[model samples]
Target: MAPSKKMTFSRRSFLKSSALASGGMIIGFNLFNACKPEAKLPVDLSALNYNDFNAFIKISEEGKVTIFSPNPEIGQGVKTSMPMIIAEELDVLWEDVYVVQAPLDTKNYTRQVAGGSQSIRFGWEPLRQTGATAKQMLVNAAAARWGVDASECSAKNGVITNVKGDKLGYGDVVLEAAGLEVPEDVTLKDPKDFTIIGQGKGNVDIDKIITGKPLYGLDYKEEGMLYATVLRPPAFGQILESFDDSEARALPGVVDVITIGEKVRAYNDSGKNSWTMPMSGTDKVVVIGKTTWDAMKGKKAIKAVWKTETALESSETHDKVLLDLLEGNKFNTRRQDGNVKHAFANADKVLERVYESPFLPHNCMEPMNFFANVSPEKVRLVGPVQTPEAAAQVVADLLERDLEDVSIDMTRMGGGFGRRLYGDFVYEAAEISNAIQKPIKLVSSREDDMTMGVYRPSSKYKISASIKNGKITGYHLKEASINGNMYGLIPNFFPAGAIENYQVDTANYKSNITTGAWRAPYTNFLASAEQSFFDELAEELGIDRVQMHMNLLDNVKNNPDANIEYSPERLQGVLQLATENSNWGKTEAGVFQGLSVYYCHNTHVAEVADITMEDGVPSVKRVTCAVDCGIVVNPFGAMNQIKGGVLDGIGHAMYADFGFVDGVPKSNNFDSYQMIRMGQTPQVDVYFIESDIDPTGLGEPTLPPIGAAVANAIYAATGNRINKQPLINNLEPKEKVLG
Candidate 1:
């Protein structure tokens, strides 16, 4: 792995430093700070200030420091973790530091996104440099004031001390630091010196979250803001023909009724459409009312007509298409090595199996809501969105305003899981506000949120392996999905370089139903299928499952492919850790265990599932996971992420199911959609490998392997292979559906 770049800072000639109203210092730096105009500092030194950069630190006269976190916090703990990185280098007391969320600033910040678990991975070095530069400036100021060489002064815990034992608090030199030139270079502390980065810290928003304070988008309110409930088409292929709002208008607190979708289409037609634009079908009825309840009631009162514009898709039809495509010769080759046809034909034995997964909704607890106010002068938006920069741009395009004129304030999200990555709800709110020329908060009911989601694409994987002389000689993987195939990254992962004659082919059937990133994206299900297949392969070869994995890893390590994306050493470490901690081959009688290891989202994780008989059915009792994501920024937060990911993976694989019938979702609410309850949740124990490598992602990596581990455990206990999800359908044969 490449070491993190050593960042440098220098004084910009065009910009002038200014003092705060209370005469404190505010230091800010960005990679492109020299090219951009100076950011205007806020007058109040105590209040959180928005400056241009990844992040900035503020010093008050009372020796208190505030760090503004730039990225969105979608319950991933970046709001707390990112600021911790800054404070660690700033040499400040963790208790005296306060963290605040920064607003959207495209000109000042880059990669201000919260997807793919890249927040900390990308923020690691820049945030460290930000704090280190500020600390160096303070030290320089103190040295200059004391009439001593800067090299003789050292800073610790917000205080500067000289060689002679003279000391000064950061606050005492704040004004001097503000006027001094920024140091060109500062050395970062070694990993051994870190105190706050590795320590456990409570979430910055935990208090407010538990106390029911206003933080999420649903809790936001504005003066004279109207509540909106949109009535969309009931099915995927359907379009809104017309709606009569006579009864809706008569309802008390109903302000008005309007239609949107034409403007969105017009924007797309204008040739400015991009991937960031909303893929959710257009055409909907917006009911404006005084309260969310009134708007929802008004929506129910409206009578709407819908007409199908395309073929009404059904799950049975999708299943048939996917299976047929797998058998057909037409396919797009994703990866190819030696000839697989020749190897399979000459092999002594061949094993084949198909794994299937259905579409899944994100099921975010807060639903979808955004506050938008469109005036002739500017557009103001406040909500929980993962991609605020994209949301602002799309609204700007729809309203034909300058991007600079649109401002977005990101609120803490109840849950994102990749649903908020799209800006469909944001543009809808902007459209509604612009139509009425008033501020509006668009709220989606649980049903609406589930039915209108950009779901995880339903997919099937046909994996076949050829064996010769009791050794695996070839491997082939065929994938078929709705709208898309597995991302390009997965084809280059493990088992790719391990096999000599490897081949991967993919085919997709495009559908009107919106499908996009969901949590770990395709890896969420792919890992489960791939891991389960590996276990079966091990059994077919008459080798211990753990030993087989070690051998394959050894192959990759000895001779690696140029396209490989994972580290064999790291993966081997986690697998060993997890297996040892879980007592892989030494479980007590009546207890069956399965292991799975995977690398994704730049992190390596290994999971072991323990299962036992309950009421004559296999039950997951506990899950033990080992992770190697370089460094653990916050142990408590990292553990929470691992536990959550493991549970989410097991829940979806075991019970969560979604299907479409005649273009309509079969499960639109909790009553129909199954989720793992607290009682059914397994005990998850997580252990992290200690390393000096820079930190990687943790939010999504732990999810991929857990499903496979649980499925393999079930197979071990019941002697029934689960090739389909939800695993419940196969475990209970009566509930199974045939293509």
Candidate 2:
């Protein structure tokens, strides 16, 4: 099959074009091309015609528009929200606009990554400009035909009207517009004039998803493609030594057995450690067969020997190491303001607490899977991945092929809480295909997905505060974790500006176990610890929790810090909105409440959890949340993200637990791993702060606050200050609670 033609437009080279055989207009713009020095402006388009250009916007003779979305969709609703931004500024009817996922095009797109909840935030301005520019060109064409000044013509709902009341549809002038010179400047709609944005629009793929369409990597297949299942080391410190595959090869449908990872192992041993590279070890045994079942069975039949290069790590040992680091005096100071040592020495009162959390797996609904076909000419990769460009690069490097020879097609991901950000699975598929010189689909069972995962690091935090004469004078925080510490930007958030003598110190112990970003990353657990500590500090100071937080926010707002990364005004707004809507100080009988507020991912969120006792057990009944993520693109999709984040926060903090014993994962599947069920979900009420500011991240900001809210509420109902995660472990017995 011949590759499709793509024409990319930018502020520079806006009029550059090629001859096309059709009578329509297709427009596209490189989101980041404006900053490049290489883009030449005002290219001649007199020799060009319209025919076969396929890009962001496609206009038909019937006036229908198709906008291609360029970002990978990992259940963050970018697929729906991104195109909405274009259609809004293009002045097109929403019902007449169709959306399609654009294939990976690194040449024409930037920041295609899906993690960090930054898709909408980065695409806001560029997308609007593209749409508005196309609409302006259409209006210009209509004005020229009417022999009137372009400024005298107006466009609305894909139609252009002049001062004389002459009208022309976008489709009528699209072909002529294609030949016209691109305008250097275009007018964007004011927020108040927005008709499609901020309105509720259903997800474009909702129908396909509900009808069980093949949208995920696990559902993808190709003609003449084989299946592959890999056998990896059971423990982190172990590596593949040898494997006997004669019995496995004798199986009925088993095709072949092979070994991979020598090159990767050499790369890792070269003394330059790269966190972005695969962490699931470099040695693996692959079993290929005609079907998935045959491959899995052959893998089960193989006999493999492993060797350990380092001491096997256990959760108990990690616990001791983290606690010991906290108790010791040696640490790395992340941030410091004023004189913390003097403030602590001269304080009237001192309070301290330690909080701990276990490692967690993403446990996406669809297990890891990828399809690869490698040949001397080109490499084709299809799968669900959060970082498609990174995956393509890794595969290119692994196969020792040119980067341009590799192509990626991103399918809709079932779930990617940062786990899919790594391209280990993609590398495996490509490596196997390159070795066998055939197309193959690599599938991982649930057990494989869980045990061999880059998980959320287990961590511990010790927070201390000094109160002098009914006011907090000093604040200090110490962090200890596995592999890494909190991101450098986090120490400058919230309490940094609020306290005069504040200090933050961090320490970590390196282990063979692989750990990386999970959900909101460090903030997922850090927010819970800090918020819970603040609640206890308020109680010790004889002040109301809400008032205490408000006062602290005021301090930050009054005297801002140069290094502070959050907006005090925005944080205060969400806090006030959440408290007012949840009736913070007042609740009906049999109800107990808790509140928490946090800022991350360039967004602010506040939550209040309401709890009720059912049969002597504290049960979360509802949660109220207020979010300030700037202007919401799609209220319906935004609501879903907020609600899903809140529930996920509650579920993980309440039930999710993971551990390693003798370097092997303790839980291999959901039966062994604990998770909150459908019956345990709380009613989440979300409210958005009205604003015209550009949008920020929504997917991760709401999550950081919900766990803290639920934990505080549990304390209110049971009179127990839980300082650890998987709150079920710390909750008192039903008999003791009833007494």
Highest lDDT against the true fold, candidate: 1
Q: In angstroms, how far off is 493's CA in candidate 2? A: 1.0
Clash number for each model: 0, 5
Kindly provide the TM-score of model 2 when superposed on the true structure, using C-alpha atoms. 0.94
Writing each residue's lDDT as its tens digit, candidate 2 over 1-739 gives 1221123345553323211345577664566553333433222223211111213577765778887777888889999999899899889999989988766764434577888989899888778877888888888989989999999999899899998888999989888887787677777788888999999999999999999998889889999999999999999889888889999999999999998886566556655444556565457999999999999999999999999878899999999999999999878898999998899999998899999999998899899999999998999999998888777776766677887889888899989999888888888898899999999999999999899988899999999999998999999999999876435227888888899999999889898888888999879999999999998899899999988988998898888453698888888899999999999979987799989999999999999999888876667889999999999999999999999899889889988989999899999998889777899998989989999889999889888888789888888877888899888778888777631
**Residue 507, candidate 2: alpha-carbon lDDT:** 88
Q: Pick by TM-score: which candidate is best?
A: 1
lDDT scores of the candidates, listed in order: 0.86, 0.84
Candidate 1: the clashing residue pairs are: none
Regions more than 4 Å wrong, model 2: 1-10, 13-19, 34-55, 266-274, 485-489, 560-562
Clashing residue pairs, backbone N/CA/C < 3 A, model 2: 20-49, 20-50, 20-51, 21-51, 22-51
